[model samples]
Structures are given as C-alpha cells and as structure tokens.
Target: MVGLTYKILPNLTAYGGYSEANRAPTPLELNCSSPTRPCILASTLISDPPLQQVASHTIETGVRGNLAIPAGGTIDWKAGLYRTSSTNDIIQLASLVLGTGYFTNVPETLRQGVEAHASLSIGAFSAYINYAYVDATYQFSGTLSSPFNPYADANGNIFVHPGDHIPGIPRQQLKVGGDYAFTPEFKAGFDVLIVGSQYYVGDDSNQNPQLPMYWVANLHASYQITNNVQIFGLINNLFNNHYATYGTFFDQTTDAQFAGNPVNFVSDPRTITPAQPIAFYGGVKVTF
Candidate 1:
C-alpha cells in the first residue's frame, strides 16, 4: 500500500518568546525584586504566534502474498513496510527555568520499526507464532536533563530535555505456541511469552538491572465425556513463576532511606503481584 499527506502553517514563538514585548511583567515581579535578583522576580510570557500557512506530506508502500495446501490444511506468509516523515509548521519559542544557564532547543526526532509472523492449520488442530520489534525513540540535540516540571512553570522556563532510549519499550522478542486434537474428544494447548530487560524512564539509564526478562507459561486442556457435556482445565503461569510485568524504581522512597537501599547509584524497584497463585478449578462444561 502507498499514501500521501499535506499540511500548512507559519512559525510560532517558544514558551518564553515574549518577555517584555506586547505586554509588561506581572506586579509580583515589579514588587518582589529588589534590584538584586530581577530574574528571580520576573515572569516570562508565552503566547501562540499569529497563525501562518503550513505544508506537510507523507508516502507509504508495501507488499503481501499467501498460499494454500491440500488435506483441508494451509500455510501462509507475507511482508510489508511503511515510511513516514512530518514536521510541525510553526517555530516554537520556549522558556528555561535555568535561564540561559541551562537547557536548549529539543532536537528533531525520527523513529521506525517492523514486524512479521506466520502460522499453519489442519482440521481441528492449528498452530501459530508471531513476533514484533520496534525502535521508537526521541533525540535531543542541545539540551540536558531538566528536573523541572512543565505544568508548574508559568514563565516557560525550566526546559528539561532528557535523552534517548525511553523505558517500557522492548527492542526484541520471540514467541511460539501450538495446539492439537487428541481423538477429537480431548484437546490441549499452551502459550509462553518472553520479554527482554527494559530501561527506567528517568535519568536515561538501561533498565536491565531493574527490569529483567522472564518466561510465563500457560496450559489448557478439555475432554468431552458426552455429546452435551465436557470437562476442562486451565493453568496460567503454570509453574507459579515469580516475575514482574510492571514495576517502578525509586531512589528516594521511604524504603530506600531505611532499608539502606542498594548502593552504587542504586534504587529499589517495586514488586509485582501475580494473577494466579497456583490455584485450580474443576467443573462440567455443557454444550447445546
């Protein structure tokens, strides 16, 4: 497939674009400063620049194919790709809590990723395996980490731009699962999901030490004793594996202050509660 897009607009000012122009500073600054720290009392102004005409465009293309097999069975395969590039129409002026002493413009960023999968099926039995990979990230050209929060700053100062490799997104993964019919009256299936270690979002660091990859297995089986009744069982995290699907690492948490926390720029990662604690359920499944 292929596609195109277009947009138009004019450049605008940054967060602290107008400090003394178009409007005067608030009375707080006029009264708070004592000629010693004028900057500390001054309030920066931020307003969207006058609307302007802008232009935009996009292009995409890909290919796909499939095939069939005999004995009421089939195998399939395909591949495709897309490329997109876009830029905001207006030039945005921004402020900095660190004044000219720190932070700078946020660099333009580009991200791309791809995925593919295939499966086969015959009669009541079928098997499938799928995998996807992505490398989405943002790049900052002339700025460093600014701990300041955006919403709290009124002057637009506090320009805090962090570096690349955001946490939570994985770079690579692999999965495989299949099921078959046993005498048609009895059937079973299983699945396993695996993920590689990720990074923590803050301070821009590899998450490996905090987030580790682990395998989770699942099992399901069912047997029909009559045309209208059957028995089935399900086991998730079959081995009662202890793993973390999601958690947080804090360096200044209460636990860190007392438990002494891990040294060497260390942090205490949160614990995750699993869904099943090696429990079981049995009952008769009915069919009409």
Candidate 2:
C-alpha cells in the first residue's frame, strides 16, 4: 500500500490547563496525629501541617502535526504552552520540628514555571529538544494544625508558609540522532545529547551556577550474518567526555529546619571528577 498526505494550517492548540502544588509529601504530614483537623505542633494546631511541599499551579496547551511523503517516510512537529510551580521538596520536608518530639522540615514551597518541547523526523533521521524555566521560593505562612498537642509558636499563633521552587529540574535539554544503513545487511546509528544545568533540591545558590552543561554521544550497530542469524554491538560514553548526571558532592540535608540535621544537600552539581567509565557490549544472534 502507498499513500501521500500534506497540510499546513494554523499553529493553534492548547490544554484546558492543569495545576500542581504542595505535591511533595512532608514529614509533618506523615506525623499527622489526627486527620479531621490540622495536625498540631504540640497538642494544638500549628499554622500549617507539613503537606506535600506545595507546588501551586501548572498549565499545558499545545498543537501537533504529521506529514506523509508518499513513498518516502514522514515528518512531525509539536509545540505547546505550559506553566508549573516548583514542587515542595517532600523528601527534604523531613526536617520540620513539629514538636519537642516531632521535628521535620515539611516547609511549604512555592514555585512557578514554564516549559516547551519540539521534534521532527524524515527518512531515517529524527531529533527533538525540551526546555523548562522555573521561578521558585518558600512559603512561611499557614501553620500545620492538629489536635495532639496543638502547634503554636512561643506567642501562640497559627500561620502558613508560602512555598518555594523545587530543586532538581533541568532548565534545558537537546537531543539529536539519525540512523543510516550502509548496506541491506549492515546498519549503524548514533545520537548526541546535551543537557543544561540543574539545581539540587533546596539549593538556590545562583552563584553556584546551575549544573554545568554536559554533552554525550552514543552509538550502536547491527549486522546480519545470515538470513536466520544476526549480530549487534553498542558503545556508551563514546566521546569519553567528562560529565556527571548528579553533582560531585551529594548532600542529604542539614540545617535549622532539621534543628540539628545537616544542611548537606548535594553540592558541586557537576563532574568534578570525570564522566563514567567507557562501556561497550557485543552479541551474536542465531535463529532456527
């Protein structure tokens, strides 16, 4: 069967919209002594009980299209509008001191963001890229409320914290690749990927520079020895370029929020050492 189709219309598409906040679960939330009311600091309701940190809002809208090249192949394109708040660092929220016996960092966080992605393909080659921009902060309002002991400050008051940006979101990413067959029996392909900087959870040290830019190359090849048999091999870290997915020094978290917990969040979010060791694999296949 053979067919051809093509069309160019308006670039109009959108999502009704979506929201996400306080998504991260907090220790205070886990420490919920009661479910009906706001968990308390002592026996009284604290301003805000540790909840999934609190991301806030997200909007998604976009359009996409496809084209057929008759005997050729096809091409596709896509774009969109998106907004999202930083997610509360639920994992880090384990530091809020709910009470003398209760200490956790279920601090509320507020983050707003925008994101986009696009890609295209033709013949045997295809590629795509994605990007996200986030604005974040922390919330000190709204106190957690509970009946156990009643959460309250020395002044005996309840309030909620705003929210902050979520850590660990990469701002930009680029990936491109293509495949070509040298012969009907042998084919090989490769791709190059570039990743923008990323931040550790809770580390807003702009001066620290986002995770460094990193680029990596990957390659693969396959050969058919016979009609019923095939062989293949793959090489990773082809460029041998030094890079790190997570920074060099990883921090667990230690700070006042933990009372005495260490604010050891992963620092040096880069490859201070070097990229992973080169890796390669090969195999042969036979069919009956």
Candidate 3:
C-alpha cells in the first residue's frame, strides 16, 4: 500500500492511496471440495483440489478538514471513495445435502463505495453523523456447481452472471449520535445505526425476498466516583428491535425426514440467525 497527502488550506487536507493484497485459503476451505464424500459441517477433514489465493487491488481518495465555529467550537468532516477488484475470491456454496457446503473460488469480484462523516462539538456537548454506500458484485461470467442452486432449471445447471450482488452484504449503512457532559464527573450518550437489506446466499438471481432493513439505538452513561474510580453502563438495542444479520436457504429434508411421514412433510427452507435482543451491562473501573 502507498499513500500521499497534501494540505489544501490552514485546516483542510486531501489524501489518496493505493494498495494490493492477497490471502490464502484456510485449511478448512482448502480440504472440503468433494461432492461424492462430503465432510460433515464443522468437521475436521482434508481433501484435494487445493484452492487459489485471493488477490485484490484497490484505490482510494478522500478529503478531510475542520472549521472553527463562533462559540469557540469546531466542526470536523471527512469524505472518501474507494474501489477494489479481487480475483479468485473464495466463496461458500450451499450443498445439496442439509447443513453442508464447500468453499470455492470465484473468477473475479468488485466493490466500490463512498463514505462520509462529520462531527460538531460545542462546549460540553457534541454530535456526529456518518453514512456509507457500497456496490459489491460479481464481475465474472461462468457456471458454478452447487447443491443449493436456486437458478437451476430442469436440467440442474448453475450459472452466475456478471453484476450479481454478493449475498449477505448490505449496500448501505448510516449512523448518528451525540453526547453531553452534564458535569466533570458525569456523561451520557446515544447512537443509532441503520443497515440496508441484502440478498440471501444461493439467491444470486435475487429471486427470493431480500432481508428487511433495520435500525438499532443504544444508550450509555458514565460517572466518576473518584479520581481513581469510575462506573459505566450501557443499554444495547434499546427498543428491543428484532432483526437478522445473516440468512440463507437450504434443504432441511435430511435432518427432518427421519421423524415421520418424511415423504409427505415439507420443511421450511430458509435458515436465519437472529441478532441479539435488548441487553444491558454495567461495570466499574479503578486506576491506581
């Protein structure tokens, strides 16, 4: 990676950078590629067909500056745009059998995005906001094998087209927050985070419903008991909003079939993991 920066004005600056990097496949992904003798999920097994390392090149440019306010306060802001192209990107493919899949390399993928943030501070109170938008997609055209191929026709062939959004990654996000210092010994703050919807794995065609967008708010406070001791507390998911961060479709027949009437009964195919519910934590810190 390389970077350069210049001072545009007394309190402003511009910056840019470029980077290239690579990552090797993990031991688990390197050894789990056989359809005839698939290893169990979360099992220890090694196989053949060693995977290729993922390589990426990226370029980014941005500007940041600070402005003085009338009340001896200041506003700070930053904005940036970045693009990255990766080759031989490793991705997981759903298996035909329930709860099992293998990792394989995709020919190419691309991610480009813009991000910006600003903050204002006045006296003992401060506020800040940030937002980002990402466009992540497959940049290759080829057929890939998968047991959970949602696009397969009668003949069972799976193919990925260029410009398909990669599954499980939100394209946009936002956050805003502020804090107040009631006294030298006390402070409180709150923040809200928003996540955009995304497609599920195996639904590269985007035929299934996208995950719903959700936002979460949190609050926190701290008090100083003495010069050497302090107490802090936080409430996460303050509204107790329920959401899922990840999801995918899979065949559940293998696990449910043995119960009863396997042939007649059908199981739900969507698998989802839920986010944490409203929660709180409090603790004290002491310094000698």
Q: Judging by TM-score against the true structure, name the best candidate.
A: 3
Residue-level lDDT of model 1, residues 109-161, one tens digit each, is: 33344555667788877777666565535444333332222222343222333
- What is the descending TM-score order? 3, 2, 1
Reference-based TM-score of each model: 0.53, 0.55, 0.89
Q: Write the per-residue lDDT of candidate 2 for residues 60-137, one digit (tens) a residue.
A: 655566566665666565665554444344432212233222333434454445555555555555555555555555
Q: In model 2, where do residues sit more than 4 Å from their true spots?
A: 1-16, 19-57, 68-73, 86-89, 93-121, 124-165, 200-207, 224-230, 248-274, 284-288
What TM-score would candidate 1 get against the native?
0.53
C-alpha RMSD values across all candidates:
14.2, 10.4, 2.4
Expressed as tens digits, the lDDT of each residue in 17-128 for candidate 3 is 9999999988887888665445576564766588899999999999999999988899999999999999999987765555676778889999999999999999999999
C-alpha lDDT of candidate 1 relative to the true structure? 0.47
CA-lDDT, candidates in order: 0.47, 0.52, 0.85
